[model samples]
Target chain A: MARKGRAGAALAIAAIGSFFAGTVSTILVAVFAPPLTAIALQFGSAEYFSLMIVGLISSIALAHGSVVKALGMVVLGLLLGLVGTDIYTGTPRFNLGILELSDGLNFVALAVGVFGIAEILRNLENEHDRDVTIKKVSNLLPTRQDWKEMTAPILRGTAIGSALGILPGGGAILASFASYTVEKRISNTPGEFGKGAVAGVAGPESANNAGAQTSFIPMLTLGIPANPVMALMIGAMIVQGIVPGPNVATEQPALFWGIIASMWIGNLMLILLNLPLIGLWVKLLTIPYYMLFPAIIAFCSIGVYSVNSNVFDLYAVAFFGLIGYGLAKLRCEPAPLLLGFVLGPLLEEHLRRAMIMSRGDPMTFLNRPISLVLLLLAAAVLVVVLLPSIRKKRDEVFVEE
Target chain B: MKSLSFSSRDLICGALFIFIGLFFAIQAYGLELGTALRMGPGYFPLVLAGILILLGIIVIIQGTQIEHEPMGPIAWRGLLFILPAPILFGLTVRGLGFVPSLFLTGMVAAFASTRMRPGTALWLVGGLTLFSVIVFSYALGLPFRRFGPWLGQ
Candidate 1:
């Protein structure tokens, strides 16, 4: 019945709906405190890093596309993470002298632009053949049976995510991917894995947010920044002339505690914010296609421009947009490209730091047991990917859309 | 063996990826490529470009080797909605501010059916704008400019 209505409306509603949910969820993690910090400290470096590995594996495994494609994306993300300040030399890596990018592309801008804009383009491109009408949406909430199906996956995901959160490098994003993989691997109804499985959405979401909340513990308590966000927090601390260390908890209890407390507030706010917004967002899905496409482009530009209030970003967005469109036509997933862009500098920095620390010794990776293990694991991943049996399974999984 | 096929679409895409990769690789020559074990600034990008080229080649080969779905013609009308939405949002940022601009953008982006009144779009615009303001501005403290003199401040 709704499909009889309009395409533009549906696309708008879906996009806005997802955006609202994601924003609220993220904000909630930002506000919460005691429990959040307590959660973070549970995982240490090894588990965190191991969980990261799990995340990489899972994200690659669970991707809807071919295994090779997914792995490519994972590598791309890792590569992008590598870009930026070299740990040893403190040199700017890939900013290209664009002030906005000197700090690297903002996640919000990238996320909003790539997914949001790209999606709008796709919808508009099919506007003529498509009816701008509504598809009848099913009942919003999960049924009892749905809950039963989802409950186990959610629990397993939570466990996996929480455990991973305890480790050094593992975070919410990783947890989300890892949970999805675990769900797929262990599910009785494995075939239903990617067909809008509520378990797929729910477990990963819960795990991702929970992991995000916990990632801060090591940063606040142990003074080791686990990821970019944590690094930002460290920057905030340094700007305030506070040196972060193991004793930070004791030395600045209020600041630490206050931030922690804020996280809870954020989380509560998210629940309140997201639930109601879902209705409004769903309602948006009723709009027509003609008016929707232009608006998405406008938003993309606005989002990009906000990064530095510069026109250059507009040009960059256009450039990337064209590139994005081209890649889309090719069936090359842009996710990996973005990932590579993000990680490129970071990877460089880490490799450089390890090398300098080792005094130019190539074997320095081996000297650090943790680093050695990581290297070995990376190698193993490559080897496994090359194995014919695994290769066949991977190829089978990535159905071309 | 099942039949393998490559559409014209696949060929075009492969060519573009390879082109971009080559461009990046060439530009990277100016930047230090760093050492084998110790990475420099250009190392990741250089490697990424190489991989992208390789992937492009693989995609081209795979496209050639597989049975594929037929793609439809370019829907030029659809481009109007998709292209303009984001650009307008950016242009109006400083003038209308985040909330109002968001409202306008959201409204413009939404397409009500001929049977539906404009009021539906209005309501959605109002609703989404308000929610974004509340969540991002009030809750997350994103520090976006509100309406009036505070614009871009």
Candidate 2:
């Protein structure tokens, strides 16, 4: 197997880019409360629900592996979320008194174990036998055609992500997925995906970054979280006992506005950081699989253990890793499962809450305009998928590894 | 020559999904599920189980209709080691501590390599161990205590 000599350079660039992107987006979300709040003050619950609906659908788009496998992964994610604890009660659901699982599986542990450790296992199995050919050196610059193809998708993604981010749940991640799906569906060339379509990278990347920036709108204005990351931010706020609400912008303008200004600054920072570092990031691809696999395992173990200082998560990681490996062997992509796991609980909780609010009227789903719209969209997708003429296209879309 | 196919395997997988969905439905029934409006604990799982059952039926039907392209027999050696590695990690990780457990795990995993030589493998393992320690402990600042903390400390 030929190693990409420049992988290290490429990886370094990506790391720098991602760091800047992540940090700037975070700061912007944190700082931009007052002005953005004023701008978004008119929105209400329906808008919030629509945003969440969009996020949920879009998150499903993020799985880049086999469609069936991704679906299975999503289901598995939902199952994990449901395994323990009734939200309304103080009682445990599936902890079995292990205590670590009382809170349900930690996201970090699940992510690290399945993605990190299982990846190592797969690499190890293929190490020596696998041909390690790296592509011939090519220019990193995007061509004019590539730029033309990417611009519309990126703008659309930004709009979709920003709008969704203003809602109470479904943050940057969901926006990323939503943007990806939109771009894919609308693109004239739908088949040129999974092979690093510039649109695939550019659009979702833009959406996520923009979504990350906009998610602070609800958190700062109305005191609601758009996604888990924003939830973490809310935790940070609560530690200070600043009960987040509509008045947050009025009460703490600098804290709100500073965070917003920082986002713009942060995006610039990321672009600067990542642009020159791509070469370094690329160089990381050169590391021998032997060395890389072990590192992945070590990272997974460490990441999982740090979540709770418990050794049990380590065991869980290994277990999931095995499951991940098995899924891989079956040619199933694990992305969907991961997404399902993340969204399953939310979907369940929301659906139940809606039912509870409606007091047994099943028509509530159809009667509510927002709910009806989302359901209709979902139906449209299903109908398109079920058509015989689209079967080959569906397979191609879902089975991309 | 006459050919065999994965029709049986597909059929089995489809059946397994259906069974799993039904089991979930049964479990949902045991929960206090309540009225449609006042959904108890089991509403979501019940819905999911129903959906999964539908999907399972589809899979079974599709499997029956598809033609399987023949690939040769499985590589038993690779299969045996690779399949068990994750399980072994799960079984051992908690009690063993990170470094020692990982060393053993990596060593075992290396056996899946088709052309691995013993000496080369040993060197790779050492490099892996060191790199892992430095990157995870030093770079990421993860609290990884070396095994026993006695030999060098």
Candidate 3:
């Protein structure tokens, strides 16, 4: 639609869709969070372990490309996560005797290196003069035809996004992708999808915002991060001396309600601010990639260094950047690795605790009904991903983007 | 008869995974492997290492059967300059201070693209450094020295 000079309409549609989705999802979070927290308070180590297993396996399922490769990436990430001092024995495992290794790798450094620096390198691979043509955005309001086309997709997207957002490891990216796939499949004008149908923009935009809003559910209720952003939020909470668990909702009702209220206000502010700032965003797009990347590199260095005032973290950023680029070259998805990195220590802790509780009985996982259900769900997801028909369909879904 | 062939991308990928898996496994083996009821720090890693090795083998086997696309262009220039930007900053930030270290880092990174002229690179880096100093150091009060003792400040 932007290519066809419907930039204003596209932007407005996206803004409206996102606002609607955000409102609905915020309400869903408010209504559902208390009950969810009550249920989560009952969970034990076995349940937590099974839950993380489901999270890990689903990340693998959702990742693009080979299943075996994704699994390997997760394993590698787990090993990397274990690089610091062992929590149980205080034994330094993979630090190579460096004192910095005792504290383990900085998460921000790893994230910036893998996702940020590696992305810059990829963009630099085919550096050419980009021809950015900005069309004057005149019509901010959607036509009646566009409104008719977008209503059902926005509703469907909101529902899908809200549900998926509550699952650990599921977030805006997966929700938007899933929503786009559904819109394409159900649309009578499926051919118009890649060319920018109104449903294509409206559905994914709505889903993305909705997913982002409701991902807070898992974070607020269970203290389980649904995505990296939630992980960062948990980190911040920990810094503030707030233990993020079911008790948080009860103990800090004001803070919990305040965050939910802010979500709605944030959505409203986004629409109010962004509609007028569309021209500024388009101007930013006109900046040359060559000029932009240097600034990115400088800021990344400063940001990473400021985290702990540790220069070693900066070196780690460089090291992980190389690894990230190498993995990209090798066709491995980095998302699973990142997710694994975040979950690794927690997973180990829960596994060990559960085993200790069960007196070394491996059947303890199956003995607990909730744990059994979660494990079964993980198994079902793995099996479905491995199926030949679904595998092909999965590839096709990714290829559309 | 079909010739035995392998996807080089997968072949290299599998070898990398196997190598890393082995590296972790050997280290874990040196640690105490406690019972399942009370897993030592190493036990969990050892299990993960084993899974990684198995997955690597599966990837290798699959590579032999499947004909994959070529690996395409490697970012040699980007790798040459871009990877060092942070390392350079790390090395010099304390000694040279935030301003010069950042300027140097930006200058190096700017050249990652072949399109960047030396003059353009210098201008871009200079501007970035100025902006960062104003925002990060002055405004945000990140306790970075504008000029370190090495600069006789």
- Candidate 3 residue lDDT tens string, B9-128: 989999898999998999999998899999998899999999998898899889988877888788899999999999999999989988899999999999999889999988878988
Best by DockQ: 3
| Model 3, total clashes | 0
DockQ of 3: 0.87
Better of 1 and 3 by DockQ: 3
Q: How good is the docking of model 2, by CAPRI class? A: acceptable
Q: Clashing residue pairs, candidate 3? A: none
Fraction of the reference Cα-Cα interface contacts (below 8 Å) that each candidate reproduces: 0.33, 0.24, 0.92
Model 3 alpha-carbon miss at residue B27, Å: 0.5
- lDDT per residue for candidate 1 within A45-120, as digits (tens), equals 3333433443344334334444455555545545445444545556665556656555555544444455555555
Report every candidate's CA lDDT: 0.55, 0.59, 0.88
TM-score chain B for all models. 0.71, 0.77, 0.96
* Interface root-mean-square deviation (Å) of every model: 4.8, 3.7, 0.8
TM-score per prediction, in order, is 0.62, 0.69, 0.95
- By TM-score, how accurate is candidate 2? 0.69
Give the TM-score of chain A, superposed on the true chain A, for all candidates in the order listed: 0.60, 0.64, 0.94
- lDDT, residue A4, candidate 2: 35
